[model samples]
Target: MTQLPGSYESYWMESVAGADHRALAAGLEVDVAVVGGGIAGICTAWELTRAGHSVAVLEADRIAAGVTGYTTAKLSSQHGLIYAQLLKSLGAEGARLYARSQQQAVEYVAEVSVQLGIDCELERVPAYAYAESSDQVEQIQAEAEAAREAGLPASFVTETGLPYPIAGAVRIEDQAQFHPRKYLLALASDMVGRGGHIYERTRVVSLDEGKPCRLTTEGGATVTARDVVVATHYPVFDRAMLFSRLEPSRELVIAASIPGEHDPQGMYITQEQNTRSVRTAPYGTGQRLLIVTGEKFKPGIGDVSRRYEELAAWTRDRFPGASITHRWAAQDNTTTDRLPYVGRFHPGAKHVYVATGFGAWGMSNGVMSGRLITAHITGQELPWSKLYDPTRLHPLREAPSLLKLQASVAKHFVGDRLPASHADSIEDIAPGTGAVVRVEGRRCAVYRDEDGDVQAVSARCTHLGCIVHFNDAERAWECPCHGSRFATDGTVVQGPANRPLEPRRLPTGTEDSDR
Candidate 1:
């Protein structure tokens, strides 16, 4: 097998020595049960705990080890020319509310880190959305004007600190970059100190909504709470049909150690080259970690391994003398209208609230979600609550994007069933790789290891019955339809899909003879 450079683990996860919390082993009751232990859940739980509400956070895996740990960790409100679009779609007042909520999150993180004495390496830096192409210059200018109108400290500029040149840029100051895991882990610990409970490796499989919502874990442990916040990144319980409203995309990230003099000194992004985001974190003495993220594509679609290469090449070419030290991927969901759904889970639900679809700017948005959801549960009316309400109907604005997303999903669901999408026979399968092939006229996801051992699982995704595609980069079966992922042996990796893929046994005659 060809060796891949650097570790597959996230740099944030590797840098911090995290403390483990036990999984759910018995049933319990709390005032609030927060599902998902990443940024949103932990922040929500922490806020609730501080508010004198009994809260318990149930995590499918380790706290902050999921998407939170994999993020670029830029805590800024400059989410790539969004103010201009928000001004058009949501109007001036709505855009102002959006800016205020996000800017508050940035300030909130700084305040909390200082109050709690958590050295999260929070640094105040300017953020920029630059135009690499001349055609994008006008867009940048419009964004600058729109952002300033929305009350953000934004301005249009032609010069930046990037090694390469730019046409125009929208610069926003008083933003920040930090170590998310360190910050979140500290918050998790503080939540514990405040009598809040955290259970790791406890996956909630079902939710029974009522006056006091009930959640059942995969291990059969039960949690009943007066209110529930489904902060799961993809939302495990999608009673509101978020699968259609939200679109999932995975992006590649590469980090390299650069000399202190080479640090970018600020956060930057460009829509050119698919999507490029650049930021830096303090590393070992006199060194900085240059984190570059780009090559956004639908999960489970296309050549992810090649996308990694393309991102790496872009980094090497842009930052000379920088050696790639770590590589990882982060997945995010974008809503039809581009703003996150952060209030009530659905129109009918009374006790269930949801926070998802932050696009690619989860750091600030996640903090915003924590505060917004807390206010909702506590009956504190917030100015921006209605703006982020999941039930808000924007038919004219959302219809086009929603329809386009559903069409792509329908194509994947029905189109992948065709014969051409499958391999001819197991004999053609290569070692250390996986493919969907037909066995006895049934589609099976088969993988042959380098040792010539074979394993097969049903190709159907348990979430939506979409065919699973093998991701060579991650060595997992990914559902292109809804972003559910499973290991080659069929264990669920990420969700929206709660169950593992069923195992399949190949007929003896169909086995490759070389094995």
Candidate 2:
């Protein structure tokens, strides 16, 4: 087996320049305060600043270091066989509106990159959704038809640039791809140039909804703003039980260097059950990097190592000579109705807006979110605003999925409280792995770090008390209920859970076991 790179580092992170933003230190007032410094927050800040609004962005970490940095960075409206489902759940007009918004977002990114002279490796290419077997061909055909009806330039085709053969495919022309971090870095610079304040390592802990909204930081500093955008991949403030409504899934991504002669001409994704997304990025003057990503599962529910091995096997079988370069994983939220929530945080909360549940197509949706939220804040009307309104509901279409997700939450919430499946002593956990063990009758999360030290934390998720499972691949504690994740040392990594996992004291006898 090929040894994987150390701890989940994304290809974009290795290439992009870091932003030297300081943490929020004192109370301040701004026209708009945007939380989360990924693409959604940065784009929102850029748009608001462009409109002459004084915008302040408060990020728990550096800019573009979240989902944006980890994405496949395909800037396309061709979101894997979605139009057909949209045509069914939403009507034709709704589907068209979604298509229009996504296409406009793609164009907007291109326009911005060109206008800003950002060399983010932006390239225009066709996107394809293909089927490996005849059984899946009809879905591809239907998707092509639905896409065309929804204003996307799509057509049914059997021939593609992929190395593997396909039964059929839906090809969408003029789709684009780029290095998301580079693009966002340029935008962040422009936002600062326009008098926008962006603070890194500054986490917004609580929000007070009023005429002038107040956000309290983890450092005890306050930010008062007329409007606030909670663009933090998963909304941290769960005032309306947003966690229960959105289902979270984790997907693994791996990039490898391939022979220049075998570079694919377009981005492609499989339409079958085991979805595989494929795209190529320019590595050097004459070489290309092939990025293959898939293997999605409910967060904290699967064997992460096995999933990574499976993806690696799939890649080797297809491109035997490919050299593994980078590997990472990203978590995305999916709503019951298959559309994102990108408007007001909730009904009756006019000043607070949120954008989430983009599924796996956040490249375009993130940009659309920034544009949509900015429009609402600046008193400008957008046609597709109602479709993405967080308050909108389709009870009949959404009820089944919503109930299913809630049932899973209840099962894990109760199941995790019972007992540890394996009664192996905490010392049995090998180095570089983690497990839940009963410490003096209380379940605790125990991770044996690489340096042979044992790190323990309360297994209970700080969000809603759901028991968190150890993700061995990432060395993090992940909540099965609503996707809250924490590092082994008990710091919050992903949220909806703003508080870090509570540190636990190891039993006296367990301290020197590894020694």
Q: Best by lDDT, which number?
A: 1
TM-score of 1: 0.98
Residue 40 of model 1 has an lDDT of 95
Residues 1-515 of candidate 2: C-alpha lDDT, one tens digit per residue: 34675335788999777879999999999999999998889999999999999999999978899888889999999999999999988889999999999999999999999899999999999999999899888889999999999999999999988887889999999999999999999999999999999999998899999889999999999999999999999999989567878999888988888878898899999845467999999988677998988998888875888889889889888878888888999888999888999999988797999999999899999999999999999899999999998898888998999999999999998877775543368879888888888888888889887777888998888888988888877878899888989999889888888999888999786766978
Q: Write the per-residue lDDT of candidate 1 for residues 338-423, one digit (tens) a residue.
A: 99999998889899999999999999999999999999999999999999999987999999999999999999999999888467
Q: For model 2, what is the error of residue 154's alpha carbon versus the real structure, in angstroms, after optimal superposition?
A: 0.6
Against the hidden true structure, what lDDT does model 2 obtain?
Answer: 0.89
lDDT of each: 0.92, 0.89
Give the residue spans of candidate 2 off by over 4 A: 5-8, 421-423
Q: Candidate 2, residue 461: CA error in Å?
A: 0.8
Steric clash pairs (candidate 1) = none
